[model samples]
Target: MTDRFAAFRALHHGDRPLLLPNAWDHASAAALAARGHPAIGTTSLGVAAAAGLPDGEAATRAETLHLARRLRGLPALLTVDVEAGFSDEPAEVAALAAELAGLGVVGINIEDGRPDGSLAPPALTAAAVAAVKDTTPEIFVNARTDAWWLGVADPLGQALERARLYRAAGADGIFAPGVSDSDTIGVLVAGLDAPLNVLHRPGGPTVAELGRLGVARISTGSLLFRAALGAALATADALRAADPAPGAAYPEPPSYVEVQRLSAPPGAG
Candidate 1:
């Protein structure tokens, strides 16, 4: 646990910002691991949507746990986006953290955003972070503040305030997902005591630019999952349109055998 935690922490301090891609399921995680990504994070949106539940409302705790348990044997470090810790009670959240830690999960992302579109009280969120650390000291608790994401006025100020509280509560990193501007990101990078994580927007700063802004980590959040869904719809549309003559050039996908191999046990031939 200590070694895995240390490796995840080290990724934040590398020359370039750690490109932490978020995965939805076993196959997605295994594919990323096979591509040599050092770590993989579970997307809360993907988990919730895949289960036909809503995200950020604490509605997918069971699904999140099931995915975490299944992902434990993969060859990469795993961090889970357990939306709002799935409960407001610190003890319950801590218990969840302990469970994930036992499954070899090295990190977790807990947000302060509520489904009602309000930020959770900073003190309450801080208590949750403290509880998780107390329960499993080795798990990297990434305290997330969605001030910018909620479109709150003075989002930077709100985020900075939460950052201080969560960091003092023993968070290893701070994630502000909707902060996209260079100036705000640089300020967060300088102001936060722990590593600052920003979401990677498509048209916004590239990974290299974010690295220059001193971001320690860049999260894809649910972009990959959403993109996959979009691609699937587009492919279906193309297939239907090409039914008469099949003239369109279809995109090649992995063979069934290759996808089947992804589900095999790590040591199985």
Candidate 2:
């Protein structure tokens, strides 16, 4: 367990940034593991929407834990996104982290953003991070700040301040999502003590560019899940518009047997 935790932590210190693909379920995680990703994360939005719950409101704690349990046996390291730790109480959040750690989860992403478009006070957020670290020292807590996401005034200053607070509170990594500008990204990467994480945006800096700017981790938060949804809708539309032909050629979709294989454990009958 210590070795697994160490390996997951080491991924953030490589020559290039670790590109973490967020998975919503077992199949998504298994597929990514098969594709040779060293680590995988859960997107809170995907988890919430799949469970028919609202995101960022601490509504999917059960759903997130269930997904983590399902993904425990995968080859890649698993890190869960427990949005704001799913409770304001730090001890409750620590208990949740301990549960996840017992299930072979090596890390978690906890943010400081509230559903009502406000930031949790920095000290409060720090306490949550501290509690999780105090309870489970092996679990890498990726502290996330939403200054840019919430369009706060002076986002750079706010993110920097929060990053410092989170780092002081023992965060292993700092995630500033929605911070796409190169200058701001560079500033955070240079200023932060822990590994810096940036959200990957389509039209923003490419992974290579972010790597060049010294980002230690690049998370595709909710992007792949959203892309999967978009592709499914487009495929359905394409099938509806196509003329019925005996040998019509369309994009080859993964077969049912192939998808079923994703659920099977290695060496299982």
Regions of candidate 1 where Cα sits further than 4 Å from its true position: 243-251
Clashes of each: 0, 0
The residue ranges of model 2 lying beyond 4 angstroms of the native Cα positions read 243-251
Tens-digit lDDT track of model 1 for 1-269: 58999999999999999999999989989989989999999999999898899988888999999999999999999999998899989999999999999999999999999999999999999999999999999999999999999999899999999999999999999999988989889899989889989999999999999999999999999999998888788777777777653335345666899889999999999
| Alpha-carbon lDDT, every model | 0.92, 0.93
Best candidate (score: lDDT):
2
Residues 1-269 of candidate 2: C-alpha lDDT, one tens digit per residue: 49999999999999999999999988999999989999999999999999999999999999999999899889999999999999999999999999999999999999999999999999999999999999999999999999999999999999999999999999999999999989888888889999999999999999999999999999999999998998787777766878465134445667899899999987687
RMSD of each: 1.6, 1.9
Q: TM-score, each model? A: 0.96, 0.96
RMSD of 1: 1.6
